[model samples]
Target: MLRLIAATLCLRCQRVRALPANLRSCATLSSAENRHTVEALYNLSVDIQKIRKLKGWVLHQSPVYVREVADLLKDMGASGAIVARILALHPEAILCSPDQVRAQRELWMSVCRNQTELVGIIEKFPASFFTSSSHHVNQRDNIAYFQSLHLNKRIITKLMASAPQSFSRPVGQNEVMVCTLQQAYLELGGEEANMRIWLQKLLSQNPFVLLKPPEVLRQNLLFLRDKGFTTAELLRLLSKLRGFVTELNPDSMRHTLAYAQDTMGCSEAELRGIVLECPALLYYSETILAERFQGLLGSGIRMAQIIETPTVLELTTQIVNYRIQRLRAHGYDIRTGSLKPLSGTKKDFEMSYGKLQLRRERPLFNPVAPLKADD
Candidate 1:
């Protein structure tokens, strides 16, 4: 009788065999969630263990270190994208410090000897790794802080030993401190004070030439030599030297020549003649000429009128005739005649002089008081 009842019950359960799709999906999701949770915990433990092995830290996993690592990650301020990239690259070290963090930071500051190496290390770490906002300060301030920390003092000393060729313009007090540090590094070897004194005396005399290149100095000296600058004048100019000596700006050549004249107490014409001999100086006068012409035109003076004035006309005509004769001597066809008109538009008429009819279009004077053939 019990077997009969069980068989009947089994037949009824077979008739209701199909479960609803939604209920089946729910069951599958629950199983997947449990699997992922267990896998994630296992991976976390493995990563922590790996970090401990690699860094050779014997310290037991402490809540404080874990919290510190969490805080560091939070302060890193990296977006989710960057965090994902970092994790993918170092999955095993993702949750723990790679080494004794404080010791590593100190080593970074000390072992790397030069600014280039220091900068490289700093660049590798995320900005938040430094912990202090002051670490991100400017180069000068950063150097100072490094020195105060007594970290990497030997490398800093080595870097300071090389003589710096350029100092920042408008140098501040901090920069001056950096300069003093460099000077102190040099003084460690003895006779550094003598070098400073020599530089100071040299700068005191030729302040203008201090920043100028050696080539520029040579060029200027050659120019002065050609201009017959006296020994005293040269000495005076050299003695007043200051920062960043450089060649005079090409555009300022004329003004500089004028200055040279004044400095030497020479006449303007004499100075100008000397300037013309230096091809480099031609750009200055040419620029001045262009400016002057622009000003004249801007003032409403016509160029044609200026050149066609009675005095200028005579001078120009004489020069033109002289040039034409020279060209003729060289077997070139040359023509010279009075300015004349031709039949056309005004411009065409103006341009056709000598090539067409010779009727005076704009006479400067009535036929030079016609001479009598009887005379």
Candidate 2:
């Protein structure tokens, strides 16, 4: 019955918007008696479990209203918990006419394809249903335009998962943005006709890149290009992790670069090398980078070696400190391996240098901050 209401009345109710001053002719509009029944059910005392069932309709459920709204959601696969959560976050959503909610739910289900997917997104963004069906239609058009790009399903899913709000843009605006990006990628060169496909995939993997205005993406590439990254290097960075360009703060990148050259004694060429190896280093706090370099030097690792093995920069201060202290306690020299172990995984570290068997006799590791040794 609820499904029937969702399928038949959703768009029809949306078309009406509101009952006219003379609703006498409209057959589907809930009568005053229906409102009274809803109020009666709402006031009826019930167990906590049943309360969950009534949650979405408690505040505003005429017989017709409950049938169309809450039951529609339940029919679409929203659990009692999900229904409760949506109501608690936006109880006034129940005040919306049943038709609007049916239309909205139908729209969500069309793209999301399942109750779980719909619920997961709602959990993350509880206000998703706040907008009217008109807003939803616009967003739906944006998604349809993306599909029209001939992108693979993997790319589409990834993009939507990363930045669901992209669906909220006006359909016309989204069409323009997609066209702008498509042209940019085509001119990006390489793979000829496949360049646009590559660009779509790149944006999907690095959804944060799409959150920025299209101009920002262009400006970032230009910034890196002017900073001596060749076309190949810029492409590598954009493809691997576009956020390196988009999330980068120019001041932060510069300060880290200066620290690398002046304080750490890395030459210009070496700094560039380090960035290519680990572009994320530019975003690290100056203080931590300095401390890590100091620790390495204090342990007899050469500055030139550190520059050559720039991958070691990915090591956190806590992991390095913990490893170094453990090595010294067990009479092992920290510099014996030239910090090669720094690039190894946690399992490798624990099995080879960590001596986990011995650690068992000691206090437990703190899961909250595993970097800290036992007090």
Candidate 3:
């Protein structure tokens, strides 16, 4: 009992000594109420280990900076929870001065449309806006750079949200790439106005290409050229599907070709022609290729027509069956199919096939919308 009393006295004396220092340095923490409010701003219960790692930095941050950052975000309609998530990411982000935080927040709000959209972007890629490199006016500059290229705001939003890493690249590197791609495109016989138009469309369509190294583009082109793809053919292929080139390695390419020749029963000549005609073929897996072929062939689309219009290999079974049934109902022959359904754009297909009128004419027929996925 005497030893226990001695240990309790020492613990009390230690707390007494530490209290004076804590009160002297941290006026806010001197009161339990103030301490509770300050912590409520940054402390969240998610990812406990990571949030704990931020504690030391939080201790040294100025109370004014912390208060202002939280107030600024809250005033603009950000909730307490969102503020906590942001601060937990980088406690020093509070040290970024309240004005800097407000400016970044507003800029993101403009790009993402509203606070909820901005929060989604933050959740998707926190480093895009909350990192040290993203502080102050960097977000505005990055945004202005894309706008300078005359890209529409909708396209910019899509690009930023879909692949935030696209904006994570160095400013100069991005500029150099745009210039190089333009010059290379011009060298390939593109006229000046057409080159700008083409680049805009292609960039909007395949913004992910910006994330790749220049070597990747070069390598894709060289590999195709060596495989008997003409420059014209290569460009056409890329326009249809940009991801195909990046997703394939030499081994995968070989396997893809083998499946087309062996499983799909395409001859060597037919395989070469198909790859040249529809580079999307290289992008699809062997499984997808097999399924598409079986689906089309099972719809009574003959082998010769399938070879002639290899793009039919892109459609799913449900779609193939739907179009075939509709064609039969409308007295169109499926045994000798035209390339219009598979090769043409959806608008073209709808216009040429009169899908809308056909559907209205035959109440029992319901053509699935292209964008709608089958269960």
Candidate 4:
């Protein structure tokens, strides 16, 4: 349903703005309901022209209760402008019956502390709040189920907003996935007391993990175990990947490992060390690895340097080239120096460059001179 709405309601502001005012007004004035919806929205200071450009279909669809939606949002402490924006962005909200909106409000209030927080969440993620009436039962059950697990309310709210599909499914499906994750954590030698924290963090980091089948995680773990990863190493990998470990299947992982081994001429031990250092290498396609490798080699970086700082492989070729060029201008040759400078984010590279600049410009007489008061 969301997909259908998304496909139909693409916001082409430029094209919509190009339409003549007469045509726009005629479309909105074609029916009494449309005129009423438009007048109510206008009264709330909604940019009718903008909404018409984005979702003119709402004006055409009858039985739209813009006033009811406005009243609900206003009751939740939303200002007039917010009410207008919400309607404009997600006009489908007005299409839902008053009963559905009230039910959704109550459902959200279960996790949200008060009206202020509820309004804030709606302001940020309107779609999550104004879902179909059909999902009400599943949403209620899933919320209760997650609460029963002792997961944080904030995390549950986030899951609903970001991964609504998780909450829309029956509680049994999420239960199975959660069990699988807990089992995997225990099997990896995670302590009993820390299981809740681990599970909370995993779900918080990647709620869509609930959507994956239990068998995929089992297969991935088994494949890793067969590839000589001990339980301890597996735990570390899981921690490093932040619950995205389930994204890797045996076949893709096998192909990636083969490519990395062949390209780097590294033995099994060396490859394991590399993967442990940067788990992305286990999931990165051979094509992407080849591009990054070529980017580094093309910059005169040696194979040994890459082996030493495997994390640099995470950076794109464009970023690698830009950093290398900057370092060369600063007379810090990455070809001879360590690849550490290029291993992190853009800010990290700038900090490393600043340190290099300070080292290059420091006065040689500082050692012979007296220290200043501040120094």
* Shift of residue 79 alpha carbon in model 1, Å: 26
Clashes of each: 19, 0, 0, 0
- Cα TM-score per model: 0.21, 0.64, 0.60, 0.84
Better of 2 and 3 by TM-score: 2
**Which prediction has the highest TM-score against the true structure?**
4
State each model's CA lDDT, in order: 0.38, 0.61, 0.64, 0.86
Q: 165-208, model 3: which lDDT tens digit per residue?
A: 66655666667667766765665456677765677676777777
lDDT of 2 by residue, 1-375 (tens): 899989788878766665442332423423323444333223321122343345534433433343345565677677666665555555445556777776766766556657777667665564565455656666677667767777665565555555656666666755555555555454454455766666676676566555566666576666666678766666666655644356775667777878777865766766777778877777778897888788777767777767767766777767777777776666666565555555556777767665534654466765677484787
The TM-score that candidate 3 achieves is 0.60
Number of clashing residue pairs, candidate 3: 0
- Give candidate 3's whole-model lDDT: 0.64
Ranking by lDDT: 4, 3, 2, 1
Position 305, candidate 4: lDDT: 97
Clash pairs, candidate 3, are none
Give a tens-digit lDDT track for model 4, residues 121-211. Answer: 8888888889988998999999999999888898899899889998888999999998988888888899989988888888889888999
Tens-digit lDDT string for candidate 1 (65-88): 333433333343433344333333
lDDT of 2 at 240: 59
| Least well predicted 10-residue stretch by lDDT in candidate 4 | 24-33
Q: For candidate 2, what is the lDDT?
A: 0.61
Model 4 residue runs over 4 Å out of place are 1-33, 45-56, 365-375
Model 1 segments more than 4 A misplaced: 1-198, 201-212, 241-245, 249-375
